[model samples]
Every structure is written in structure tokens, then in C-alpha cells.
Target: MVSDRSKGEVSNVEPTVCWVVALKSEAKPIISYFELDHQSGNNIFPIYRNDKLGHSLIISGVGQINAAAATTYLASESGAPPWAAWINLGIAGSMDGEIGKLYQGVKVINPTKEKVFFPGYRFSKIVSLAEIQTLDYPTPVKKNGVLHDMEASGFIDFATRFSCNELVFSFKVVSDNSEQDMKLIDKMVVNSLIGNRLQQLDALLDKIITLSKREKQRLQIPDEVEEVFKQFHFSVTMKNQLIQRLRKWKIQFPNRSISDLVKEAKTAADVIRNIDDALTDLKFDWT
Candidate 1:
């Protein structure tokens, strides 16, 4: 995937991790740590990238709608591949956790919409996990054990559409607790909170990157399958089915050529059926 930057140069690296942050203050530390270069001329959202690291960051303004829109914007602008990981990292108000503590959201609940999202593989060994609740407004009042945020719900909802839930994650650092004053949080403070947890973030990213690479390898379109598409016109649904069937065939008969089975196939349906039949024959043979 290549993205045309404002300077007219194209980024050759396809990002493996996309970070959606709600505030510039929250994004400051990450951009510096990753050494991401800002892309000029994108007025709607502040976009930053480090192609070498395969990491991209977008600063979405506060609110659920903004978060969702920015996530979509980043995906479009970056030309992010389907196998890329999507992460929403920022600060949240927590009632039970200590201020500046970082946590991975295991379960995200949108109270207003009554929607629940369980995202990402649990990095239990790397950081503490907590349940997050997305609210429309900032509530200084305590909410028991839930971490309060305004963006995770929207971020997760839109992000999962681009990538699987297993590759989408929300990690928040406690910026304000019941004992701490929200008004006291300045840009420097927000940066510090996020910066302090870079070590933990590094560990999480290592795991996520490995998972994304595995997914990329699994989802890669075979050259033979691409040739088949050139020969036959397949609808979106048919294309998906064909790809799925080919994946099974490749696993079952790695040394065999899928083209051999589909050479007699006159249509997309025939190609899929042929592959399915081959897989079935192998299953029965083993039994």
C-alpha cells in the first residue's frame, strides 16, 4: 500500500499498526517516541507516520463521533491494509485506579448506545486490564471500577470494520481520578502520563506486530487466485467465497496447484465448487 503525502512523495510501507488518539496532548508522547513525521495539508485531522516502523497516528478531536470519523480518515489516507492492527490509545478518567496508571480495556461498553465491544487479545502479562465505559460527557464523579472515556466505543465500532476484533485494541492511562482534579491536567501532564508507560506499550506492540504479520501471511492473495480473477468476473460475495475456499485448499494440499482443479471451471461458482469437492474428497479419504 502506498500513500501520497502532501510533499508528493509516496510512502512505500504499509502500516501494521494504526493509532487513533483523541487529543494532541495525548498523542504528543507517542509521536515523539515513534519519531513520526507530520504530514502537512491534512486539515481535518493531524496525521503522523513513521514508515520504517510501520506505525501511523491520527489525532481525532474529542467525542465519539470525532473518533469514529478520524479512524476512518486515517485508514483512507494511509491506505492501511486489511491485516493491519488498529489501536485507540489515550487518557481516561478512572474511579478506582491511581492516576497515571495504564490499563488495557478488556471490555468496552457504550452506555448511551447499550453496545458492548470485546476487542484485542488480552495482554494480561504486560499490563493491568480494566473495563471501560464510553460516556458522552466527562464525569468527574466516580463510576466504581469502570474507566470513563468518550472515544473507545466509536473507535472500536469503526475500527473492527477495517480489521478483526482480535486486532483492534483500546489502552488508556488514568488521567484523572476522584481524588485528582481534572482541571489540573495540562498538556505536559498528559504527555507525561502516556510517556511513562512507553515500556509497557512497547511490549504490547511487539505482540501485536507479530500477530499482524501472521494474519497478513494467511490473508495474502495467491498469484494463481489473482490470475483466476482476471479470467473470471466474480461478484464481491463470490470473490470472498473463492478466497476462503482457496485458503482451505492450500492448507489441505499445499503441494497441489489450485489452478489444476479450477482449469475446467467455467465460472466462479464452478471454481469454488471444484475446490470444495477436492477438500471433501481428502477429508473422506483420511476417514
Candidate 2:
């Protein structure tokens, strides 16, 4: 159960999107695009935010561990709501993609840890999709059809824990490819790669923001449900069940009060049973 107090702690800023980038160069275009202000006093990781737009960002220096740690740090400092979207955006080496083409990482694999993570909804119309493999060190693209990066696997692995898989995304712009050499790429090159794709990035973000809002509504706990949580001693499992049932009940019978129906219930099980029984009774009546 999300108690009001806990909710208050995380709901203050109500950021709708959190971006995790591996380098300052990668973050530059996005920060400018979103008009996010640098949060002062945090040197461990450079954080930025625009409360009104519900956007927050963190620039992790480099590598998978840095990406993961920076993600966790941003989540903690930003206090982003659980429904907020998480995006890992940066440059990557591709086996065959165009030098500046952007692609969403449909599948992310961490070769070092032998972990695989599928992140984000398929926005087929907005951008191209590709497979991303995160490695410990920068290496030339040795395989075909895969985008090689150093941060996505770490970002996805940690970001999904803060939100859901559908809300966590990894987008990479091909900075170096077969024709382009990775060794020659510089900060200016990184900036240009990401900067050129801002328009497409905007389109993707608009869609994600829409989905995030819908998710926020679905996960919202009613005031009455909060009261029930305060009154009952629901275990973690029971709490989740109760919240799910309440959401369904609200949809089926929006005019009814779930709290009133469960007022006489003495325990957590009773609360769940009463709601289930009410839903069952309604179904039976309709038949």
C-alpha cells in the first residue's frame, strides 16, 4: 500500500519523465531542448530539472556502473513518481546504421553480466528500432545489426525497478558505424548526433508523456482507499491485491464507495473478500 506519507515524499515534484545520459555532451542537447535547469549543490552527479514540464535528467560520467548508479541517484533526488517515464539517451556505435540515425533499443543486453532487458513500448511510427548491447569497454562493432553502447543495459536494469518496463526506454543515435570510426568521434560529434535528432526525440517524448499520464491515473489511489490502508494492517501482498481490486471496482462502479462497503470488515482478508463479493454480486445482478 502507498501510504499518504510515502506518496507525499515522492509526489512533490511529480516529474513525468526522467532522462539518464552517460555524458555531459549527450545531455547537452536534451537539456537545451527541454529547458531544464541545473540543480545546484549536487556534485556527485549533475542533475537537472524543470518542475513545470515534469522533466528531470542526470548525467552519469561513463560506463554501465556509472549509468546504473546515476539512475538510482536521480530517482532518489528527484523523487520521481512511479508512473514517470525513464529514458536512456546517448550516442552508440552501430554495425550498419547511418551516422546520425536514431534508434530505440527494443532489446538491451549486458554481455558482462549476462543479463537481458527489453525496455519500452514499441513506438514503431515514431522511430526505428534496434538491438542494443552494453559492454564494459568501448569496442568496434564486431557484429551486424546491433548497436553497441556502454550504458543502456545498466540504465534499463535499474530504471525498470523504479517504474515498469513499458515506461523505461533506451534511445541511441548512431555516432560511429562501419564507415565512421569510433576513435575519431569527439564531444562535438556526440552533440551533433544527438542535436540533429531532437525533433524525433520530441515526437517520442510526446507519446511517452501521454502514456505516462494514463498510467498515473490508473495507479492513483483514492482518498477512501488511503483511509482503509490507515485503518487496516494489510501485508504487502494484501495491499497490492486491495489496490488492484479497488481500481477495478472504481471502473465498474464509479458511483459506489469501496471504503463504505468494507467498513465492517475486520481484517485485510475481509476487506479484499468484501470487495470481491460486491463485484461478484454486481455481475450476478447484471445476468
Candidate 3:
């Protein structure tokens, strides 16, 4: 799978990870570090990609909805595989941290609505965890031992629908807090903060991509289904159903294949119903 990164001098390897950020400043260091180039021609929003680095970034402006939309665009436009990792990385306000410390948001809460999102497994022991609150605005609200951001909730909400829960993450670099002022933190400072942590982030991203690929392998449709798929003109929904039922069908009968039964089917619907019947028979007997 060759990934396209506009005019950027990147390799043919496609991106396996997507990063969503709320500000261009926050995205600057990552784009530079990964050697991403702007593809331009985008009228809906701005995007950058690095085929060799296996990363695609979206600058989602500054809010919850923007973040969600940008993430959706990343998944859609990038045509990322289900194994591709999704990360929301940017600066945030921390109640108790130095100006530039980094954190992985293990728990994300929308304080305005009291909605909570627990994202990703705590697989990386080296990274510190933070309890983050996603607020509606950039109001200076900070609490003892908590991280404050504006986009995490929306990003996590939409990303998990495409991949496993373990592949979604919210990474934060502290920019302000109860003592530190938000007004003082400018674009240059944001760029510098994230730039300083590229080394650490590079390693973290590698871990996430590997884990996502493993999870994808666990859930991806098998190659055997391809032969059957080519014989029929299946709708999008039918294809999904076929892939899912095929996996369950194989589990029910290790030696037998539903492929032989599919040979009798005349339409996509016929194949689906045939697979459904096998699945129904094996439901009680499958051990």
C-alpha cells in the first residue's frame, strides 16, 4: 500500500498512524520533524502527510467539533487501514506541572457535560498519566492534579468507531496552569514545546502503530474471502457482513469452508443468507 504525501519527497510506504491537532503551531514541530508536506487543494480543511514516516496530520482549528471533523477527515481522506493508530496531540493547561512536561491522557472528561472517555491501554510505562478535562472554551479553569484541554473528548469520541479502543490516544504538552498564564503562551512557544519532545514522541508513536497493527491483524478479514468476494457484486454493507460472518464461520468449522456453499448462491443476498444459516447452526454447538 503506497501512501501519498503530496509533493513531499517521501517513500512509497503508506501512513499507518494519524495525528489530530487543534492548532497549526502545535502541528508545526511534528510536520517538520516528520518531513510532512501540505497537499493543498483542500477546501474543507488543511491537511499534511508524510508517507515515509507513516503519519498524517490534521490541524483541527480550536474546539471540540473541529477536532472531531478533522479526525473524521483524516480517517476518510487518508484511507487509513483499520490498524492505523489515531492520536490527538497538542498543548494543554495542567494544574500541577512545569510549563513543558508531556503527558498521555489516560482519562478524558468533558467538564461542561460530565462525559468521560477512557482512552487506550496504559501500555507505555515510561509516559506519565494525567486526568484531563475538555472544556467548551479557553477559560482559565484549572484544578489540583488535572489536565485541561479543548479537543480531546471530541477526538476520542469519533476515532474509536473506526478502530479498537486501544489504538486511540490523547497526548498533551502542558502550556499553562493555575499559576502559569494562558495569555503568555504564543504560537512560537507552542512550536518550541512540541519540538523539544519529538524524540520521545517518535518512540511513543512507534509503539502505538505496532499495537494498532496487531489489533488490526486480529480483526482484519482473511485472504481466503477474497476469492469469494471477486465472484459477486457486493454492496458495501454486504461486504462488511460477509467479512464478519466469514470469520465466525471459520471458527465454527476449522476444516470446512463456507466457500463451497457460496458457489450455489446467485446474488450477494443469497451468499449472506447462506452464511447466516451456518452461523445460526453453529451458535449453540460452537465450543
What C-alpha lDDT values do all the predictions have?
Answer: 0.88, 0.87, 0.82
Model 1, 42-108: lDDT tens digits are 9999999988778899999998999999999999999998889999999999877899888999899
TM-score of each: 0.81, 0.82, 0.78
lDDT of 3 by residue, 1-287 (tens): 12132234323455677889999999998888777889798777788987776778899999899999988988888887777788999999977777898899999998777789999867557578888899988878578788889999999998888666788899999999778799999999999999888767866865776686687678667877787788889988989988888887787777996677688999889998898887774546533
Candidate 1 ranges with C-alpha deviation above 4 Å: 1-12, 231-249, 252-287
lDDT, residue 184, candidate 2? 89
Root-mean-square deviation per candidate:
5.3, 6.1, 5.4
Report the CA-based lDDT of candidate 3 relative to the real structure.
0.82
Candidate 1 clash total?
0
| Residue runs of model 3 more than 4 Å from their true location after superposition | 1-14, 232-287
Clashes of each: 0, 0, 0
lDDT of 2 by residue, 55-172 (tens): 8999998999999999999999988788999999999898788889999999999987999998999998989999999999998845789999999998899999999999999999
User: Which stretch of 10 consecutive residues in model 1 shows the poorest summed lDDT?
Assistant: 1-10
